[model samples]
Target: MGDYASQHSFRIAIVGGGISGLYCALAIHHHCTKAAVSFKVDVYEQAPEFKEIGAGIGLRPDAAQLIHNVGLGDGLTAIAGGSGDMLYRRFDDGGEIVTVPLSREGSVKLAPCARSELLELLKGGIESRGAATLHTGKACQRVEGLGDSVRIHFTDSTTADADLLIGSDGIHSQVRRQFVSDNATFSGFIAYRGVVPMKSLPQWPLPSYSVAWLAKHRHFLVFSISSNEALNIVAFVTKEESQVVHTKESWTSTCSRGEVFKDFEGFHPSVQDVIKLMPEEVSRWRINDHEPLDRWHYLDGKVVLLGDAAHAMTPHLGAGGSVGIADG
Candidate 1:
C-alpha cells in the first residue's frame, strides 16, 4: 500500500445523489472490497430522496457494460426498454428519412431506461452493499480543503470531513463553483420535455421504435419508456423564435399549452397531435453546455468533477447521462 493508503480508514464524500454520485459510490465500494481496502463512503443529496426529473435516457454499450460489472445488470435489464434502430423523420409530414441502428452484431446491447427507474436500481445496489450511507436533504453550501483532508459545509449548519470529495452535482452544481470556479454556458436552445401514457396514442407507430424529426432549426424526439407503458417526448427550439426571459432566477419555467402549439404550428399533423396531447402545463429549461476543462481535479487531486458539472453536452447525441455513468 502507498503512503496515503496507510491511513486507518479512507473516507470518500460524494456531493450529489444523482446517477453519477450513486454509481460512483457503488463503484468505489466494489473496487475497494475486491482489493480488501478498508474505506468509508457517503453520498450527500440535497433532495429528500433519490430521483430523476427527466423523461428518459439512452445507455450506450459502454454504460451497460459498466452497470453489469457493478452487479446491476439483472436489475437494470428487468426495467429496460430494449433498444433498436433510431429513425430520422421529416418534420412537416413525419415521413421517414433514414434509419440508424444503435447496436451491432455480437456486441454489448444498448438500453433505454426511465431516469427514475435507473436511479432506484442504483440506490438499491448501494444499499445492498451495506457499506455507504446516504444523507438526504443535505445541501452542500461550500467545501474547503485542509492539507490532507477536505471539509464540506451544508446548509443545515453541519459539516463533514473526508479524505477525498467527488462532485457529481448537475449543471448548476454548487461544488463545481467552489472547486472549478466555472459555470455552464447557455447553448442558446431550450427543450420542452414530458411523458404521456402510450395508450393515449393508439394510432402512433409501434412502441419499439425511437423516432426523431428534424425541421429547419428545430427537432422533436420521441421514445417509449417504463416498459412501453409511457411515451417520452422532447422538442427543441432555437432561442430566436422563443425568447427566454428571467435569465438567472431559475433554469426551468412553466409554459401554457397554447404557447407550445404556436411553436410547432407548421409541424406535421402527427407531431401536432402529440403536442396537443401534452398537458395544459409544460416545463421548459434552457440547454447549457461547457467546454472540456484541461483538468478536473483540485487540492492535490483530493477533489474531482463528474457528469454535467465537468463536461455538459447538447442532447443531440443523447449520451450526456450515459457519459456520466461511464465516468463512474
Candidate 2:
C-alpha cells in the first residue's frame, strides 16, 4: 500500500493453486484493474495439473456475494444449485428433529456446487482475464524474505521472487510453517464421502433439501449436487485420537463400502439404502484442523496466509470454503 501509485509494476507470488488461491488471483486482478495499479501474479501448484479433490462444497451467501463482486456472477449462477432447508433427523428412526433454513429472504441462498465445478469456474475466470501465470508441479519447499521481497524455493530446485507472497494452500500449508509453530492436528473424526446417482435411488424419499441423520457419536449428511443428478453423502464417525494412526500422507484414501457400513450400522433403513448405492470404493478422509494461531503473516506483511491455511476448522457449519473465499 505504500506509494504503489508511483511504481510501474508490483509482483505477487501465490504458493498454492486451490480454490482460495485461484479466487485470490482473480480478486487481485479485478481490484488492480479498477484502481489502475499494474501488477503481475504468479501461482505455483504442487500437483501435475489443477484439480479439486473433493465431492461437494457449500458456498454461504456472503461467499457467493464475493464471487459476484469479483465479476464471476454469470459463471457462478451456471454451476450453483438451488438452496434448500437442512433437516436434522434421528438416526435410529429417521424422525425429524428440526429444520433449519439455509436461505434467507431477499438474500442469495446457500449454493451447493461440486468442488471440481467451482475450481473450473475459478480457473476459467483467471484464464479469461489472463490475470496470472500458473505453474504446475512446483511444490514450495521453503521461503526466504529478502528485505523488500520474498524468494520461494520449490522442490524441483526452481526459485522465484516477488514483492509479496500469499499462502492460500490448504490445511497443510508450507508457507504457514514459515511463521507458525503449530501444525494441523487430527480432529478425532473421520469421514467417508462419495456420490451416488439419483437414478439408482429412485425410491429415495427425501426431498432435495439437505439432510443430516444424527446419532450420539456419528452423523451422516446427504445433499443433492450436480443439478440433482447425484447425491453427495458424507458419513462421519468419532474415534479416539490415539486410536487412529494417520498422517498427512494418509489424509485421504479409498475404502470399501463395507467399511462405511460397519461404522454406520443400525442407522435407519432409508439411510442404509443410500449408503448401499454409494460407489464400491468410497473416500476416507482423516479430518484435521488447526489450533488458531496468534498471527498469520510474517516478514512485515511481505508474506500472508488465507483460507484453510489461516483457520482450518471442522466442516460442521459448512463454512470452510466460504470463509476461505472471504479471506481472499
Candidate 3:
C-alpha cells in the first residue's frame, strides 16, 4: 500500500457524473498520465446518461482556464458564446444600474454556455480517454471504510471499492452524509429556470451580453448560448408563492406557467416578455445550501467531497461551479 507503483494499480471511484464528478475524473486522469502512475477510475451516475437541465453557465476567467487545461478548449469554444458586457438592471423599468465588461486583462472573456452543452463536452472528454468507465443508473446508497480502502454500496445491490472516493453528487450527496453529517436547508428561495430560442423574441432586442434584472425579493438572469441561437433565463423569487410545493426530496419540480406568472407579475414588461416565451410547462428548483463542513474527507483521506457537496453557495456570485472545478 505504501508504494502504489510497486503493487497493483490504484482504484478511484467517483460517485456522480455531473460537472464536478466528470471534471474530477478528467483532472485525475490527466494527473495520472503526467505522473506516469498506474490507476483505474470509474464514475457512477444515477441517471441513465449524463443530462443537465438549467439555464446557462457563465464561465469566468478562472473556470475557462481550467477547462482549457482539461483539453476541452475546442469543444467549449464550439459550443459556448462569449458575453461582452454584463448589466444589472432595475426589474420594474429595465434601467441599467451598472455596466461591466466581463473580460479581464491577459485572460479570455467570460463564456456563457448552455449547461447541457457543457456537460456533453465533459462527457465526451471522459469517454474519449478510455481510461475511465462510467456506470449509469447506479445510485450510491452508502459508503463504508475498510482500513485503507473504501467500499461504496449501490441501490442496485452492487458494491465498489476504491483507494479514493470522490463525491460530486450535488447538494443531497450521500457521501457528504457519511463523512460530515451536515444537513442542507432551503434558503426561502426557488429558481424558475428555462431557455428559449432567439428567433421567438424577434421583437425584443437582446445585447451580446448577460443581463440581470433585479427587484424587491426577486431577480431574473438572461444570457445567450449556442452561438446566439437561444437565450437562457433564470427567474428567482421568494418561496411564498411555492408554499404548496416541497422540493426537499427532489430539488427540481414542474409547475404551470400560471404559477410562474403569479410570482412574476410585477417585473418589467421586458422581463415579462421573456418569461412569456418560455414553454407552457416550466421547472422550478429549491435553493438549498449546507453549513460549512469542518472537514471534507473521511477514512484517512480515502474519501472526499467536492463541488456543491462541499460548498453549495448562492448563485449570485456565480463561483459555486468555478470553485468546484478548481477543487477537481
Candidate 4:
C-alpha cells in the first residue's frame, strides 16, 4: 500500500472468518486499493455459521481505538453499556473492595460486552465496506505456501488457491498448529460464566459498576453487558488436580448451581447471593494460554497468522479479545 502496488486486482483469500478475520480484511482493504489487493479475500472457518460461540469480552482503550480505526467507533460504543463508573466489592462479606469511576472521562473504554454482539458488529462493519468475502464451514485442513501465492486444502473436500492467506482463527487453530508445535500452558484456574436476568433479582445489589469476588481460592466477576439485558457473571476457581482428571470445561461447557456452590461455599454471603441468583445452567472452562511470539506474520509469500493464532495470551487481565482486535 505504500510504494509498491499490489500484483493483482483482488485483495486475495483470507483464512479465518471470526472477529480477527473480519478486522484484518477491513484493515487490508482500507490501506490497499481494490487493485492493490488481490483477486478475493476469502475467509475460511471450521464452523458453518459466523455467530460467536463463546461469551463476552472487555474492551480496553487500545481495543476501542482499534475499533474506531477500522471505522466501527460509533456502532461499537452504541451496543455496549457504560462500565466507567463500575464499583467493585468482595463478596466474602459483601464488603466493598474499591470503587473505581471510569465515568469521569475515559472509563467507558475499559468496559466489555457479549462476544457474539461485538462479532456481529464487526462483521456488519466489514461487509458494509464491500471489501472481503467469507467462507465458513470450510475449515483449512492445511496451507501450502507457494513462492508467489498459496494453496489451501479444506476438510470439506474443496480447495482454493489465492495470493495471500491470513490465519485469524482462535487458539485451537489448525493453521497455527502447523507452524507452532508448543502446547497451551494451563493457568491453574477456571472461569464459570452465566447471565442472570434483572427480573430474577430479589434485590439487585450489583453496583452500577462491575464487581469482583476475591474469595480464597475462588473469585467471581460481575458486570452488565447491556442496559436491556441480564448481568454477566464469571466465577474463577483453582482446578483441583486429580490422578483421573478430565476436563469438564471447554469451548462449550455448561455446569450447574450445585457444582458452582460446591466451589464457592467459602466466600461471603453476598457472594452466595450472587451465586444463588445464578441459574443451574452455568458454563465453565479452564484458562489456557500461549507464549508470546516474536512475530505474527509468516510471509513465505503471502501467508500470515493473526490474533490468537499468532500470539494467544492469558485472559487474567481480560485482554484476550482486545489483542485480537488490535492485530486486525
Top candidate when judged by TM-score against the true structure: 2
Model 4, 38-146: lDDT tens digits are: 4456677778888885566778777877778777877877767555455666656767777776654643376477778888887887678776776678988988876
Please give, for residues 1-328, the per-residue lDDT of candidate 3 as tens digits: 4454259788999999888898898999998899998899999999998898756887777787888897988788787765567888887778878888876676656668888898888989998987589999989999988887889999999999988899999988988888676688777788888888878884754464478888878888888888778888888887763583565324257788787788878788887788789888887777777788888887888998999988888777877777888899
| Cα lDDT, model 1, residue 287 | 81
Tens digits of per-residue lDDT, candidate 2, 1-328, equal 4455247479999989998899999999999899988899999999999898668887888999999998887778777765578889999898989988777777766777888989999998999889899999999989998887889999999899888899988899999987777888889888888877767885757654488999988999988777767678888889787755742324267778998899999999988898888878778888898998788889999999999999999988889899989988
Report the lDDT of model 2 for residue 135: 91
TM-score of 1: 0.92
lDDT (C-alpha, whole model) for all candidates: 0.81, 0.85, 0.82, 0.71
Off by over 4 Å in 1: 1-5, 103-106, 206-208, 246-252
What TM-score goes with each of the models?
0.92, 0.94, 0.93, 0.88
**Residue-pair clash count for candidate 4:** 12
Candidate that beats the other on lDDT, 1 or 4, i.e. the better one: 1
**Candidate 2 wrongly placed segments (more than 4 Å):** 1-5, 246-252
Model 1 Cα lDDT, one tens digit per residue, 1-328: 2356476678899999998888889999889999998989999999887878757777887888889999998887777774667888888877779888876887767777788998999999999877589999999999999788889999998999888889998888888889566677778787888788778985866334588889876888888777767778888888842477643323257688787788788888877878888888876767877877888889888888888777778888888888988887
Question: Between 2 and 4, whose lDDT is larger?
Answer: 2
**lDDT of candidate model 4 versus the reference:** 0.71
